[model samples]
Target: MENTRFNPVQLRRARIARGKTMTVLAKETGISRQMISNYELGKTIPSGNYLVKLISNLNFPKSYFSSGQASNLHGATFFRSQSAATKRARDMQSVRLSFQNDIYSVLSRYVNFPKVDIPEPLDMNVREMTDEIVKSMAMQIRERWGLGTSTPVDDVIRTAEVHGIIVVKTNMTNDKLDAVSEVIGGRPFIMLTDNGESSVRRRFNVAHELGHLVLHAGVESIHDFTTQQLKNTIERQANLFASTFLMPDEAFTESLLSTSLEYYVKMKKYWKTSIQSMVYKTYQLHLINDDQKLYLNKRISWNKWRRVEPLDDMLKVEEPTLFQKVFRMIVDNGIMSEADLLSELKLPFDELECSLGIKLNNKMAVSEPKLRLL
Candidate 1:
């Protein structure tokens, strides 16, 4: 506390990380709410006992407060169901994303992760996009990435990781926010809610955000669009991207022999897509009529497959392993010890775990044979 200067941004960031409002933090620390506001605004810096109260209540290390505010990245955060997500929830996830971004930066200094790879940049004019255009673009990505010929994508998560996207499952407070994507320091990060969703849903979320990164992020300020209708339109396009990307058009139409739920349960085994998505694609492909689509919906509701589909438990849940593998490589190889990481990042174990998605399962006790701090 003596050498480290208090960063007001860090204080606000930590407050949101713990999902604390100003008044709630005031209650926890027994500090006046007005003074906490002043401290965060940088109108006044806390000294003596006030500082100790924040340290005790927040559980962040002294060095964290000293670190300068992170620079805002160029790309805006793209959130699914923006209208449905609460501001507080968005704030918490954004801070968590920034932390994970920083963790990525620190780790990249020791090793290289995949760089952003796309066949080409997408059409800048989002207004001109249609279902056909989106489908064509999805096909282009499938071919460019060598996902395989008319076959089910072996692993969308693995494809993303191999092609230079870092995907992490986030512990989202809001159920509405399925996923978020932002370009932090030129690196794209996609965060999905780790809410025990089915494997197909999780895969769709990742693909949707990848759509944002490819279709919307650099091309425009999509998140800042003023109207909800436009947002929904863009979101629909991304969904098309995901659906087409997951279930290829020609192959899907060929294999969708029946719209029956029992038949789709087997399709789920093959396409690894939810029955709903497959049915929607079938309708879009003109293989099913409106009446047929309605009948399928009724059957889905009757079978209770609307929310949790068949084979959800049976199919393997896809997760990102690039970070986990790299982190172990660094620590196990003595590139950086656990204590050194804790000291360097200046975050408590839980907060670090929140961002990095790794559980070290140890307190910050001073261990023997200390390595040089980074």
Candidate 2:
């Protein structure tokens, strides 16, 4: 077969994802590092023999180098690997992946998968009741963790992982919803942060799903698995979970007696939540009476600004994403490599730019070894 022309930029990015330095790759492929550098920089075209060696060593398919198509797996878009434009999305992907692991670990203990128990339509009222379930589970979970009423936002997640659950984050195609919590064939799983949400929003999405895992586990066997119904149920459950998990009823009431909106807003940093979520929980827990709830909602615009939004709208970052986290864990643990990534994931290089969101250029070239005179 005639060799297809390879994109040098794409080849280099794949190598980095594999965590193999150019020196190590040079020794394995028996190619001079300078030649590899030249190929990567588009300074020279690689011969068929060179391409075969590269394809084999890098574990990329011959097609990846020969054709310019992006990896079809996960529908990732492959831009020119040399461009740094895709970095921001990839950075958020990394954080989302880290938190997803924490979510999966937490849910796995109670059940193998994350799913709701009921088969009925999860209307607003049923969804809203998730707060009650989370409050109850939050108390129990805290006791299991050997804590008092209130738990730090991060630690709450850590404790959940100790129980076993699978948390996954994906870039949902549209403005569908914030998150989804459910079970697949008796196991528990949750997907959070449909595309365009902030890290803080992602965090809340996980917590809301956790609420479903803990409180809605009883109803999983009956769920119909339709999109709208499932979303409504899970969102309500997660909202309840987020509320109770962030602020326990007893402590919230204690704080509510004296704290104002500004105090709660200030306290948001401690809870790792937004001012609006605190208000909803306070009202639900009855810490703030009806009058206070109405006043707070109007004051905070809970109807409009309920969940946490990002502070910085302009900053862009491309770090590892949830998929990359799994990749990193397996690679770091010696369980997988770049070959496995390509074969198993069928991922394309352009998508890698979006999925990993890292920048590469000719500046960080690998140098050839100098021959020493004996």
Candidate that scores best on TM-score: 1
Task: Judging by lDDT against the true structure, name the best candidate.
Answer: 1
Q: Which pairs of residues collide in candidate 1?
A: none
Clashes of each: 0, 48
> How would you encode candidate 2's per-residue C-alpha lDDT over 1-374 as one tens digit per residue?
23346777557655654446678888999988898889878898888777777767775555545544322112111111112223434333332333333334332333333233322223333445644544676566556556677555454333443444444445323343444444433334454444666544555666666655555544533223344654556445556656666667777666554548778755665666666677777666556688887897776665455543324242231122433444455557666444443333333343333433323232321121222224
Overall lDDT per candidate, in order of appearance: 0.78, 0.50
Task: For each candidate in turn, give its C-alpha RMSD to the true structure in angstroms.
Answer: 3.9, 13.2
lDDT of 1 by residue, 163-197 (tens): 88888876555677777888776677888766777
Q: By how many angstroms RMSD does model 1 differ from the true structure?
A: 3.9
| Candidate 1: count of backbone clashes, pairs at least 3 residues apart or interchain | 0
Off by over 4 Å in 1: 1-4, 218-223, 365-374
